[model samples]
Target: MEVFKQHCQIAEEYHEVKKEIALLEERKKELLAKFEQAEKEKLDAAQLAREYEALAEENRTLKLAQSQCIEQLEKLRIQYQKRQGSS
Candidate 1:
């Protein structure tokens, strides 16, 4: 009967749609996991950036201190030379 054939066709179409939906659900789960991974990487990168900045600031401060010490040593050497000349 034509009615039986139509019902069978509808059932087949329903099954096909169901299979597609199941595949989409799996894809959605995979995509969600990827999104989480990306967020974690971004957070890690930000933390590293902060640590790098702190290290750079410390290095700059150390360089400044080293320059001051060198300047003091040069001044002391000049004073010593003058004292020796006057003696």
Candidate 2:
């Protein structure tokens, strides 16, 4: 009878350990999913930053070109005025 009681106790302990292990595994999976989502968000943010930088550079280039064009127009106007005055 004592041996039977010991066997029952061991079995119960085994089941409890198994249940704990299953719970831990489930928690691990949840944490992994969250980690994956965070990594994806990080990558997305980095990509957006890169795209924003490229756009900023392009805007700078366009502004520089516009300024140069304005300067050229003014120079041409002055030259035209001088030629007209001479005539």
Q: Rate the local accuracy (lDDT) of all candidates.
A: 1.00, 1.00
* TM-score quality measure for candidate 1: 0.71
* Model 1, runs deviating above 4 Å: 1-11
Global local distance difference test of model 1: 1.00
The most accurate candidate by TM-score is 2
**Cα deviation of 58 in candidate 2 (Å)?**
0.8
lDDT of 2 by residue, 1-87 (tens): 999999999999999999999999999999999999999999999999999999999999999999999999999999999999999
Query: What would the TM-scores of all predictions be?
Result: 0.71, 0.85
Check candidate 1 and list the clashing pairs: none
